[model samples]
Target chain A: MSEQFEMVPGNSLITKTPEEGRQLAVKMARLVIKATQPDSAIREKLRPIYSEDAAMLISVGQVVATEFATIAAANNYWR
Target chain B: MSEQFEMVPGNSLITKTPEEGRQLAVKMARLVIKATQPDSAIREKLRPIYSEDAAMLISVGQVVATEFATIAAANNYWR
Candidate 1:
C-alpha cells in the first residue's frame, strides 16, 4: 500500500481555518483508505455490509478521529 | 444517537468546488460516526483496536465512499 498521501494541484490537508481543519481531517482519512485499499469497487461492494453495521460504522469514526487528531496537531489544536 | 448532522457556523457539506465536495464527503462520514457512537471516551478506546486492523480501516473507506457518493449527487457528480 502507498504510504504517501497524494498531493493534488490545489487540494491540501494543511488547513487555514478550523472549518478547513475539519475538511482536511476528512480528506486525510479518505487518503488513508485509498492508500490501504485502492480498489473503489471493493470498497463500494463492502459498503452495504459496513454501512448498516453499527460496530463497523463506529470503527469508521475511530479512523476519522485519528486523522482529525493529526490535523489538530498540525494546527496546534487550532490554536 | 443523533440522526442530524450538526450545523456549525460557517460549516456546510453543500459545496461549490470538487475539492469542497471531497471535503464534505469526509465530514459527512465523520458525522455518521459521531451519530452512531456519541461517546468520545468509547470511540477513543476503540481507536487502537480499529487503527491497527486493516479490515476495520477499509470499512472506514466504505463509509466514506458512501458519503462521497451522496456528495457527488448533490454536486451533480461535479459536472
Candidate 2:
C-alpha cells in the first residue's frame, strides 16, 4: 500500500486525553490507508514511487502495524 | 537518517490558520529527525530496521526530502 498523508502534530491535540488521541490516531490511519490505495483517487500523490518501507509506514498509520509501535508505546499508547 | 515520530492529525490543527499549521509542521519535522538520530538516544525505536524507503521518509519528514511534498503542496504548503 502506498500511503501519503499530511500529519501535523499540534499542542492542542497532544494535550488531549489519551482516549481522544487514540481516536484521532485511528481516524488518521484509516484515511492514510484509503488514500494510498490505487482506487482511492485522492487526486493528490505524494511521491512518484512508494519506497520499500512504505508498507511499514502505512500499517503504522492504521494502528494495526506495530513496526513503529514502540514510538506509540513510549507516548503511552499500545502498551 | 532514521526517524521515528508519533504524528496524530486532528481537527484542532487542521482547522488552524495556515501559518500556525506551517509552523507546527516545521517543528514536528525537526523533532522527528532529532528523535530518529542514533545519538539522540530517544530510547524509543520504531522499526528495528530502516527500510529502503526509510531515507525517503526521513527526508520527507524533515521537509527537505519532498518525496511526499505533493501531499503538502495540495494542502497549501510548499507551493
Candidate 3:
C-alpha cells in the first residue's frame, strides 16, 4: 500500500504523559524543519553548518525544550 | 530576492508573552500540517473534508488548544 501523508487528527496530546509529550515535542521540532525546508538535498547540505555551530545546536534544543514545556502545560503539568 | 525557507534558530519562545505564544502555537500546528503533507494541492483538497466534519474540526481546535495551553505554560501561564 502507498504511504499516506494525510494528517490523522487526534487530541491525545491533551492527555499524554510527560515522557510522551517530550517525544512529541522533539518530533514537532523536526516536523517544522522538514516542513519549512522541503528540499532534502539542501537540508543535507546545511546540516554541517548547523552541526559545527554550537549556538545553532543549542537553539534547536531550546525549540524542543519550549515544545516540551508547552506540552507539559497542555497535559496540565501532569498533575 | 529569493524567499528563504531556513529556520532562523532562536529561543524567543522561551521569553515570549502569552499572546505571542498563542500565535506561535497556532503557527506550529500549521507547520506540522505543511511539513507532513508537503503538497499544497493535496492539502487544499483535504481541507473541504476536514471542514465538513465536526469531529475533525474539533480535533483541529483541540490541537490548537493543546498548543495554546502548552505555550501559556511555557510562558509560565502568563503569570
lDDT of 3 by residue, B1-79 (tens): 0112211113233444777777776665555454344456755766676678786666666666765666566567767
Query: Which 10 residues in a row give candidate 3 chain B its minimum summed lDDT?
Result: B1-10
Q: Model 1, which residues run further than 4 Å from truth?
A: A1-79, B2-12
Give the range where candidate 3 chain A is weakest over 10 consecutive residues by summed lDDT.
Answer: A1-10
DockQ, prediction 2: 0.06
Ranking by lDDT, best first?
1, 3, 2
Give the candidate number with the greatest lDDT: 1
**A2-42: candidate 2 lDDT, tens digit per residue:** 32344323322232355655654444333333322334332
Worst ten in a row by lDDT for model 2 chain B = B64-73
Better of 1 and 3 by lDDT: 1
In DockQ terms, which candidate is top? 1
For model 3, how does the per-residue alpha-carbon lDDT over A1-79 read when each residue is reduced to its tens digit? 2223322125346634544565566567766776677777988898656544333433454565567666666666664
Structural similarity to truth (TM-score) of each candidate: 0.48, 0.25, 0.45
What are the iRMS values of all candidates? Answer: 10.9, 11.3, 13.3
What are the Cα lDDT values of the candidates? Answer: 0.60, 0.37, 0.55
lDDT string for model 1 (B1-79, tens) is: 8646583313655666545665566566666667789888987787656655556776666665556555545555343
Once fitted onto the true fold, the runs of candidate 3 whose alpha carbons sit more than 4 angstroms away are A1-79, B1-11, B14-17
| Model-by-model DockQ, in order | 0.07, 0.06, 0.04
